[model samples]
Target: METKKTDKILLFKGIKLLIFAALSLFMGPTLMTMALSDKENSLYIPLLIVACLICAMAVFLIFKGIKIIMSSMFDKK
Candidate 1:
């Protein structure tokens, strides 16, 4: 069984995290837009909750991407 190399893992994780972050970022904005567009909608709370969650996930992903990128490019550890 061949073990995965660190650089390969970093590259794969960086790309995957960035992709997921992008999708989550889009979802968050769309949800927020939906919540804002219909002020009278009673489901705003749930939409807001989900939107916030998505946005938070996006932020986390971005941080992880940064970590992966920095470590892969410079840290060497």
Candidate 2:
């Protein structure tokens, strides 16, 4: 019988990613709202684009974080 130990390093990395995702989750919507509030401004398009990118990054980070955490807990080393 084999005992599986959690991979601390990977778990920590996953947690860090999740924290960043949380920040981006908040920031993306805030930026989008700001962009929409000033549609006529020159910065509107750029802000909107950046917001979209941040939202995408937040989703990606969330998935990656969960995957990494799962792997750390279950993967055989």
* Global Cα lDDT for candidate 1: 0.85
Instruction: Give candidate 1 misplaced runs (Cα > 4 Å).
Output: 1-6
Q: Where does model 2 exceed 4 Å of error? A: none
Clashes of 2: 0
Clash number for candidate 1: 0
lDDT per residue as tens, model 2, 1-77 = 98999999999999999999999999999999999998899999999999999999999999999999999999998
In model 1, where is the ten-residue run with the lowest total lDDT? Answer: 1-10
Relative to the unseen true structure, what is the C-alpha lDDT of residue 68 in candidate 1, on a scale of 0 to 100?
89
- lDDT tens digits by residue: candidate 1, 30-60: 9989998988899988998899999999999
The local lDDT score (0 to 100) that residue 41 gets in candidate 2 is 99
Candidate 1: residue 51 Cα off by (Å): 0.6
